[model samples]
Target: MAAGQPVVVLPENVKRYMGRDAQRMNILAGRIIAETVRSTLGPKGMDKMLVDDLGDIVVTNDGVTILKEMSVEHPAAKMLIEVAKTQEKEVGDGTTTAVVIAGELLRKAEELLDQNVHPTIVIKGYQLALEKVQEILKEIAVDVKADDKEMLKKIAMTSITGKGAEKAKEKLGDIIVEAVTAVVDENGKIDKDLIKVEKKEGTSVDETELIRGVVIDKERVNPQMPKKVENAKIALLNCPIEVKETETDAKISITDPSKMMEFIEQEEKMLKDMVDEIKASGANVVFCQKGIDDLAQHYLAKAGILAVRRVKKSDIEKLSKATGANIITNIKDLTAEDLGEAGLVSEEKVAGDAMIFVKECKHPKAVTILARGTTEHVVDEVARAIDDAIGVVACTIEDGKIVAGGGAAEIELAMRLRDYADTVSGREQLAVRGFADALEVIPRTLAENAGLDAIEMLVNLRAKHATEGNARYGLNVFSGEVEDMSENGVVEPLRVKTQAIQSATESSEMLLRIDDVIAAEKLSGKEAGGDMGGMGGMGGMGGMM
Candidate 1:
């Protein structure tokens, strides 16, 4: 009976590809994404100028930024982008390495697939190799403490050396170290968020400086307010200094001119009372997160208290941390204990704009880095570079471990993994060896980008790693010779390497497991109209019946 029955068919608009075809498509997508960012790696790498649909331009070599700016439509390729983002979020640097490694892993897996190795077997080998690499990384990593200023500077400099900030890496590195060090609490907890970066487009990148306290890109609300307040007792207020309207709608109607005058006087008295309360609390400066009425500003100036209105909530929180002050919401609740003391609270002109600087804070737990560059693009890139530096430094402080960079660590791990693969006794061993070869891609890319012979560099690096006490030797891009990366001050946080490997392996495995791809057709206006017409036809047919 079933032989004579009709078979159901999928709609023409729905497309599905399975098995080899699907895997090939996904692998191709992954490879293409990797190739897109491959050229922008290491110090010798070139930058990518990405222009969006609206013609806005972004010139950057940062991996995450480049990937994010690209309008990738493939689902599989997007997964690779996530790998870069995760690496960037976790380690701040090494995003390019992570994406490139993931791509290489997939390329190697494709080779294994061609040789009749099962995807499961290849993935198992990758997992094993990843675990082994982490162990190797830990073995080679050096311990760093909170007070190790020299080592911290090296870590920061290493993170900044390859990017646009390289021209002033040393100076920027010092500022980064000082900013992070100043914000580290006594308990050794380093919060990268406590360090603020402000960028202004007017000077060279080297003009960037670190400030010991918070810097607000705002000025005194009233011109008559003191530009500089010495022995500042800052009051951080969240509530509005303006008289709030009633929560429920109401109206006041005055039948006489005298009544209207009394109403205006009452409002002024309320504003004056708010300012009086702030003065009585012993606060000479006010940072208001909400709006301050004009009357309140007048009274505050008359009282000789400097005030800034509508400050960002984040800035208010930072001011509290930096000044050791409490944020008060209600004027009635304001007290002397809520006031934060600063040696000087001043409004100064920066790049033709007035900026408030709260300086000389006692033992500030938060600080700022004012980054200056000659153009908007330069300043933006410098900010990105500084952010990476801060992130790596914070990660190192938290993890208390560092690794040699410039592909040195990758070479060591690849060698160690190859040796470990020999201990295995199955076809999976080939996959493990494939994983080892994938690790070599990092150094190879570095060599290629630096215009050196990739093959020669790899051979020399392998030979050097085989020798005793030469495990940390890496290709120094400038010298084009293998050198000890650690001694050369090319160091990075251990988390960068570990996270890159972990994310790349996970992304590759996820991609390798995709054997089917089904895409739903996107509806256009014509299709939507046809569907609507079909519905109308059905309605007409019912009416005729």
Candidate 2:
């Protein structure tokens, strides 16, 4: 070693990008991901058809769904995906807006960095701007009520407007609102799981219907059992009605044939006794979580009971919520008090498959939406759209607040953020203004997707927001002009907008702060096969982003 020479400590197999190189790569990765999904924005947005290695196809315009389906490896790109996931988890809508804003924030920050502004100042500016943005959103949001069915329907329609289900937005909107409102508990808390969506192809989207109770994709266990029951008394059983077998294998030594006959009779009698218990409880409808043996089915049929076997555990829980029934673990414990009442329980063949529908409950906390379509892909996409609609409506019901859609919230927020940015001093002011500019991506992308002049629409929107009581004005893609979104019945849950902005800002700030990246290299095939020592697991992540 030469004097005054620094010695290399890092492994020769390691690859590192420092300072400008790391930031540039990270920002470019984010922009690429953002650009990939930017076209799928607004009502006129296009859909993405993703096919995996297994040849399974997914057609969607939902931002989170698209991101989840992609094989993303870049660290920064994955963070943007997380932003979309968080937005979807929190509000169920506005995922695209969140991701687009994050990408634009990074793009704007890149320019500021090129101008020699420090990253810490940029992050601080974004933080301050985030706080102010939240305030502006709250001030502009309109109050909503749980009982306002019309407004709630509008929110649902707004969420479903841009997806594959837009053609049936009116009907789906009503179904979404009804389903969500049906599951709201007395405490005004909504468990989104309580709303179940079942997709069946070979029917038009207009044929979709909402059921006041749960729908299990199972049929009667026996052909002799009743196909339909009126004024149904349901018995939800977790235990099997069949005779219990010994856990350990044992040889059965029969001395005579008559002994075997007696043994068979005894087993039959045990199953009969179990069926008698169910019949005695006045349960005409039975949903079993376990199997029902042939003998047990005969006994149940003889008692004029409708029985379904091998029902899923989750379905059993949903049945309990919908029918107000307590699941009985043992048949011997079942009684009239343990049974649940539904006006009707019937098995119907839908889309050439058997499914049991329990409907007309007094006030079910769980309900099902049967989504129908003409094709498999159409049905899948429609189901996803309904899922998003359900999520947003539930959010509105819980938050009791909404804001005008059609990019109105973003435009108003940008206007307000710019005004606030002028009050700040130093280099942070530029970052605050950058945030304001980044928000315009929503309106601009909306116009671009609609094939309208983005500049003209933005100019009109800004002019509109410049006037009093015009804060709710936004671009109407169909007319190619700015109009009040509220008057056009375009509105969404406040959570969607706020969540998108917050997640976007946070993710962008995190990406902007990254100034270095070190990736470990993988060993060659022969060397890797020799031994595992000195080989780090991070070798698989080499060249990421």
Candidate 3:
């Protein structure tokens, strides 16, 4: 290294954003993403119509869906997206709330930075606030039990009320509770995957029905087979009914037409024998996981047996659970004892598409909700809503705890956290107060989305929470009144709130700690011109994160 000579360190193409610039850029990007989905917050929240590059449109108020559909390119923005994704995966709801809180945390941290507060102090304050928030949440939470059917129903309805399925939420809530209850194990744990939501576009949302057994999006293999079978004896087969082809290619050397005819006859015999075995098993309805030979379909129809081929492996497993039928991989192994029984096996046309319905199972561990709507988009949204409802209900059962929604939980958290900040002595107390203020964004955003005076609503909400036993009181968007969320039947799983705060704080802390961003120069068609003017070469860097 020579004095007065510039040292060549990092590559010329690498882009480095250091110190305050890095933090500013990251916070700005995070705020932009937060603002993007901010409008889709509460019961009065509006839906976003996102159109992709191929012109495919998705109209949804779901936060995670909107974020995932958008082509987000900023690295820090993607981290915030991970917060929403984690929320969705953990609690199946509250993605928007998580992202919004994270954004507000970043915004507040930026203000603190401007005031000469170190990032470490802010991070420490957030961690303290997070711990206090969790303790306060447990204190404020209302306990729910697996047997509290009405409370569970309210939890489901709260999750569904803001989205596309609000009109049908009451019925959907009942269906969700029933489906989840049906699959609860002896240990009282609910597997959400056991409840399948099958959607179709044809009828109104109110017409959705719950099937005690599984529903397959497949019709009978042949139209000639019976459309409906009563007291169906279902045989679940994982193997194909078609003649097996030799794995190694071989020349048969059929020099004579008679010999070729004999070969064809042998193939027919094999197909007939497969059908005979199914008939001998006394299976009136066959759900095959593999392909069925055309000749075999003819024989099944002749035997008065309805067969559906190429069923998905997941559906097969679900059918076994729903119908109490053992899946037989080999045709020779099938018998009456290997068959599952259902009250009815029918092929019904929903939204102009044929689907197989296995209904009226006895003690089915898995079930399906046939969700119907008038349009493709409507059905899609209905499915999303149902999914959210199911997720919350399962969470409620698993944790056996819930809290008031409509921002009641957030308000309670904010109030208690501020009081908690008073006991602290250091500058970190300021950060704790900031964390409390950040949480108020939830109720504030709710009021803003509902066209109410945000300042007045926050003031009113705070005043209400200032009183004892008024913790459950929150802003009711419909009447623009602050009331008890529990009495209004607005409730959510406790996990939604706790997970949101945990995720937001952790993500904000991670972003605050990043004071430097080193990104490699991206290779693209336009940059091929070789113009490396300043930091312009780092433009449109989407994957650097």
Candidate 4:
């Protein structure tokens, strides 16, 4: 088995071993894990309130988040979680579906095994069933020919649902598609930082688009700062201020007019020295983190320098990348190329503050993927979904799109697998048939995780697809039978169609035929769940195969 060839499970012995309680524990553990995430599946799915030992609480309907947050003890449950993690990592969209389908598939196989069916026969039957289900899925899938505006919106909506931002979901989709579309290079791939969404303290629908770059809330302190600078060039510095101090311990006490005059003269001399040093450095655009005194600012201004005073410590860093200016804030002198160009000028009043967008820096971390909403919190959630969308989109763009995050489509594939499993012929046929039959439960498991009654939701999907061409009109499978996805859409992301099919096909074949769970290891005593006597707490291990 360790030689790396395909593993196979014979129908008779497979059943005999898994049918025993000890061996069955493996199956039991896997199924239980799958069921745990069943109720948190879709847009309509209810949320899970997970509380950790530290008493931290997370209320989320996101399947992956919930799974990662909760604690599961059973080793089999851990295996199921691993499967979900694989699915999620491979395809950002399908964690819930994988988990849910896996649970029910195990459940059905267990029942069939109890009814005297062998494991190998079920595995064979499921293999046969897989082709049919794939055929059905292909037939059912609506091919979106090219990226049209409407089609692009549909793509965004697919990621927006169950995200709790119903009103802004559709609108945000348009923004994503439109923003990304404009930035697509001649080579056809979107640039990484072209479309960005940042979190801000602003009301909803305050969206603005800029042909040139726009800064979110760039600021500078001091009235002596330049009102405007033409043809501004800037430098970005990563180093800290290394200015030579005039004195290590200098204190001023204004006890007399003579002392006051002396203090003023000393301060003026210090300021003059700082300004003269900066001017000598050759920067017309000076961005400073350390203090810029009034006398220094006046001197720099007189020297024809466009000095930006009191730049925030963080903005100094970010703007540095944009401006191409290296800082010697505390250092005596600087250079021209170090002061990057301050390209554009734009100002805004909203979210209760006057904000300026300074631009044309050499490099910016993220670009704004502007979206409009009606309120503050609404826009906040919209921003969150946008972040998730970015993660999903970026991941898909990187890896080949694997599968839907939710399990609806994959569960259907599993059902097809079970049907295929049923067609096998064997002396140990019954046990194998059990496995094949169990595959049918994948959809129900998905629905259960998403918080819907699996049976009822599947029926609705059938009814809708039969009558209408789309599943959007159908209820969400995870929650109780409910109305459509509302703002949700059923289309897949750009590259996942092939991947989803491939995963379904491969997992079905591997899972059904496997007779035993063997790990080549020195630690053998931890095998607590799988004994030949019977299954663990939940049910028989037949479905687990």
Per-candidate alpha-carbon RMSD to the true structure: 6.3, 3.3, 2.4, 10.3
Q: Summarize candidate 4's per-residue lDDT along 1-545 as a digit string, tens digits.
A: 56879666643222233334533555566555666666655565566677788987766655567777766544455556666566555655556655655565566556665766665655555445545655655654544433456755665666667665545666666666555554454555554455545444444543534223335454433345565555665533333223335457876457899888887787678677766766676655566555555666677668766554455666665454444456553444455545556665334454665455655543443245544455544455566566545544544434323233334444444444445545655633353344334543544544654655667766765555446544334444434553444334455553343333344334533454555543322223565344331222223433222
In candidate 2, list every pair of residues with a backbone clash: none
Poorly placed runs, candidate 4 (over 4 Å):
1-23, 86-88, 112-147, 182-187, 190-196, 201-234, 241-366, 369-384, 391-489, 494-545
Task: List residue ranges in candidate 3 displaced over 4 A.
Answer: 1-4, 528-545
> Which parts of model 2 are misplaced by more than 4 Å?
1-8, 247-252, 522-545
lDDT for 394 (candidate 2): 90
TM-score, each model? 0.95, 0.95, 0.96, 0.59
What is candidate 1's local distance difference test score?
A: 0.88
Between the candidate structures 2 and 3, which one is better when assessed by TM-score?
Answer: 3
lDDT tens digits by residue: candidate 2, 413-436: 899889899899999999999999
Which lDDT tens digits does candidate 3 get at residues 30-127? 88789989999999999999898899999999999999998876778889999999998888999999999999999999999999999999999999
The residue-level lDDT of candidate 2 at 326 comes to 93
Backbone clashes, each candidate: 0, 0, 0, 79
The best candidate in terms of lDDT: 3
